[model samples]
Target chain A: GAGVSQSPRYKVAKRGQDVALRCDPISGHVSLFWYQQALGQGPEFLTYFQNEAQLDKSGLPSDRFFAERPEGSVSTLKIQRTQQEDSAVYLCASSLALWERVYEQYFGPGTRLTVT
Target chain B: AQSVSQHNHHVILSEAASLELGCNYSYGGTVNLFWYVQYPGQHLQLLLKYFSGDPLVKGIKGFEAEFIKSKFSFNLRKPSVQWSDTAEYFCAVNAHYGGSQGNLIFGKGTKLSVKP
Candidate 1:
């Protein structure tokens, strides 16, 4: 009965560097999502995965952002050539199933990425 | 793209005061509404959600939200708030479209400060 978990609670990266944030969803969760939250702002959608398939990436701000869920369990969000504008809290969430009529999402503590 | 609005940017109240946080969405179709709370140093937690059926939905920690379709609103309320309830409250909406996976659109958030 673990909730979603993210790694590197705080990351400081230089501009143009690349960083990969990791997420571990709860056991048996089939859906995972990533979001970005600026200071004093609510989180915005980034990408979503259903099992092993990356179903939604439209929310990705740019091509530099990429995500993958290889085995339908763990996921990673890689930001290539990070910019100062990309500095924010990266959040991950998971739900039991994707097709359920109603499912509540459990959130992670989030990784605070700071592009200096 | 759907958008969520939280009218109150910040609120200050004494313990045991009645609490009401307003939220509105711009999408005109069937939507799933949610209220998430983020404590000082914690992850975002679901306060409540409204998918269908009863317009009034209750959630954990003595929180509730009412969905009013006529006004495109889903406002969160609590009979009495405690100092522990001081946190950032976010309103989100996931519009049900054709064959689309649910992705949340969140508001700017309301910062509530409850003085004990």
Candidate 2:
């Protein structure tokens, strides 16, 4: 079975530009998550979605970052006015359920975003 | 706010050497713990998790972790490591919020370099 996958393995954006990163979660998965990983650091949670409903967006750093998962499928993280500090790897993960006693997230290869 | 801590930022060991990585979380509530590994140029994969039942849990590739509630720790250990074990390891915790599992809070990660 195909695992979670992200598109545009690498992306370079100029400061103040807008960029979008896409994620395709595993088929039948009901939960999706986004994370940001800086170089030499761990991934920080960005947002979470259950089916087509956005459950958590508290992890998003600022108003410039926004995400949506319409139709209960593919998701996209869009950053408006990219900043140099936004240079990091954007990771996407998915799980089979939302309220399982234990949720094991399957991660994608991640899209490395560079803002210059 | 809950946070995870990985004591070792980097570790170097020869093949067949024993390995142990320390992880501690700051949340006092019931939490689900996880360990993830990311090989070079690869996505993160689950190594093990501790939800309940046992304190010591075994995972893939002969990996195991011990969850100590009193100590707030979930440390990963391997009896003998191989060259292929070289990768970055992450410790994460998701606290149960409002009777539902929440997003994971990750540590800074530990980079292991195993020499054959």
Candidate 3:
């Protein structure tokens, strides 16, 4: 794909249900990131991957939030026991590691997750 | 831990109006600064970035931001804003010295509404 791609552009889940959001980063890109943007707020850093390794999960809000990139490519962010506060748009981005500094991070259309 | 602040929550302007959005980061070491914009129903896109070399950097859509190290500020600007430029803007920073690397800390974001 020419840019990062996310599946299920929108999802409506009942409270306490588990949901998984998928992100397919650009081919050959070595870095992938996930962010959560609440209504009328900026995107908050959720996790980062420098390949298959989940190098940074420091930003994940709580145990209910989990992310993984098992093959250094496609990644999934799973939220367990979704609450009303969990409603937000989930974004995915990919970048080349060597071009990390000045290069712009490409973003996906974002999956808007609504927990009812 | 790295944190970012964007003082302005919302602003409204007409076409050709000048724009100035404030952004500040709290970190004691080298840092990378960035501004991202999210249009209505669109994905987040990078507006500009300050990695190194010059303290002042220009970005897309006639936007620019200057990094003031002493003040720990990276303010975004544009000489003229169009109605199409109405969007939410975010300021982000990553600790350059942190070994964890690549993950960014973002501000709450400012919503700019440009009236025709």
Candidate 4:
């Protein structure tokens, strides 16, 4: 079975530009999550979605960061006005069910974004 | 706020050597723990998890983790590591209550380099 996958393995953007990273979760996954991993750091939670509903956005660092998962499938994380601080790897993961079920999340290759 | 800590940032060991990476998380409530591994140029893969029942849980590739509630720790250990085991290991935790149910808090990660 295909695991979670992210598109545009690498991206380079100028400061103040907008960038969008996409993620395709497994076929029957009902939960999706986005995380940001800085250099030499572990991934930090960014947002979460259950099916098509956005349940938690508190982990998003700033208002410039937005995410959506419509139709309960693909998700996109859009960062507006990119900055040097935004240079990091954006990771996406999906699970078959909620954490209560103890379902392990499968991660994608992640999209490395560089803002110059 | 919840946070995870990985005791070692980097570790070097020869093939067939014993390996142990320490992880500790701070959270007051019941929690779920996970160990994820990321090989170079690959996505994060689940090594094991501790939800309940047995404290010692075995995962793929001869990896296992022991969840010590009293110490707030979940340490990963392998009796013999292979050259292919060289990768970044992450410890993550998620609370069972509040708005952070499905969101994971990750540690800074430990980089393991295996010499064959």
Candidate 5:
């Protein structure tokens, strides 16, 4: 689209429920990223994708959090068995490919998730 | 692990006053630094970046930042503050040695309140 777009601006899930957030990055963007922002905390890196290749997932807190950019355009962040501590905003960003080597990032509006 | 630190969690200033927000990062090798701003209920937008060359970088809205290599700091500063500048600011770093590649490590963020 125009800029990065995220789906379901807000989501409320009960404990142990599963939720999925979506992201549609700017067209032709080859590098995508996911980050989690807890209340009053900075956004923490969760994962990264370079043209459908999951280059990094070191920041995911647990196996419960999984992200994928199957076609390197649209991406989804799936959280299983959501916990109260998972309440926060999930942000997605994209760049004009990783090889470009520019640190410029375009961020989406972010999905606010609350685990009840 | 590479990480970013924001010295202040909240900062209050009057319009037209000078402002500065501190940011620091931990990295052992070459790194890319950036500053992003988010207005209330708005998406994040890039303010500035420091990839190489002169450490002093200028961004939109009369904002500037200095990257001090010795101190591992990239502090954002503006000579005059405006009420519109009241927002959340984040510092991020991308290091070739940090994660896989092009993954950003963000600071907790500083909330700036410019009272007119």
Candidate 6:
């Protein structure tokens, strides 16, 4: 089975520009998650979706970030007015279901966003 | 606030040597612990997870982690590491009952360099 896939492996955005990263979860995954990993640091939670219903977004840094999983399989994380601080790898993960099983997420090759 | 700590920023070891990476979290309640590894040019992959019952959890590639409630730690260990084990290791945790269920708190990753 194909693992999770992300578009635009690397993106260089100018400060103040808007950027959208896309993720394609596994065929039947019901839970999706987004995370941001800064250089030399761990990945921080961004948001999560359970079959098109966003369950959590508290990890989002600010209002500049928005995410959607309309169809429950594909997800997008959009950043408005990108800042140098927003430069990091955006990771997407998915699991078969929620609860303890959700911890066994399969990750995609992250999209590295570099804000200039 | 919940947080994860990885004691080592970088470690260099020769092939076949024993390995141990320390990880600790600051959450009092029941939680799910995990170890993730990211090889160069690859996405983050789940090493193992500790949810309930036995504290010792074995993962892919001969990796294991022990969850200690008293110590609030889930340290990863490998008896005999190979050169292929060189990578970045991340420890993560999420609340079990309340709080954020699907969102994980990750530690600053530990970079392991193995010499063949």
Candidate 3: stretches off by over 4 Å = A98-103
Q: Which ten residues in a row have the lowest lDDT in candidate 6 chain B?
A: B94-103
Clashing pairs in 6: none
Scored by lDDT, model 5 comes in at 0.90
Per-residue lDDT tens digits of candidate 6, residues A1-116?
A: 89999989999999999999999999898889999999999988899999999998988999999999998889999999999999999999998866455557889999999999
State model 4's lDDT: 0.93
Please give, for residues A24-80, the per-residue lDDT of candidate 1 as tens digits. 999998889999999989999999899999988988999999999999999999999
Clashes of each: 0, 0, 0, 0, 1, 0
Question: Model 4: residues >4 Å from true position, as ranges?
Answer: none
User: Measured against the native two-chain assembly using Cα atoms, what DockQ does each of the candidate structures obtain, in the order listed?
Assistant: 0.71, 0.78, 0.54, 0.69, 0.65, 0.67
| Whole-model Cα lDDT of every candidate shown, in order | 0.93, 0.94, 0.88, 0.93, 0.90, 0.92
Candidate 1 CAPRI assessment class: medium
Give lDDT tens digits, candidate 2, residues B1-116: 88899999999999999999999999998888999999999999999998889999999999999999999999999999999999999999988878665888899999999998
Tens digits of per-residue lDDT for model 3 on B10-116? 89998999999999889978788889888988888888888898999999878999999999999999999999998999998867663555676789999999999
* CAPRI category for model 5: medium
Tell me the spans in candidate 2 whose CA falls farther than 4 Å from its real position. Answer: none
List chain A TM-scores, every candidate, in order: 0.97, 0.97, 0.94, 0.97, 0.96, 0.96
- Top DockQ prediction, candidate number: 2
Q: By DockQ, is 3 or 6 better? A: 6
- The residue-level lDDT of candidate 4 at A27 comes to 96
Q: Residue B83 of model 4: what lDDT?
A: 98
| TM match of model 5 to true structure | 0.95
Clash count, candidate 3: 0
What is the DockQ score of candidate 3, to 2 decimals? 0.54
Worst 10 residues of 4 chain A by lDDT: A96-105
Candidate 6 retains true contacts at a fraction of: 0.78
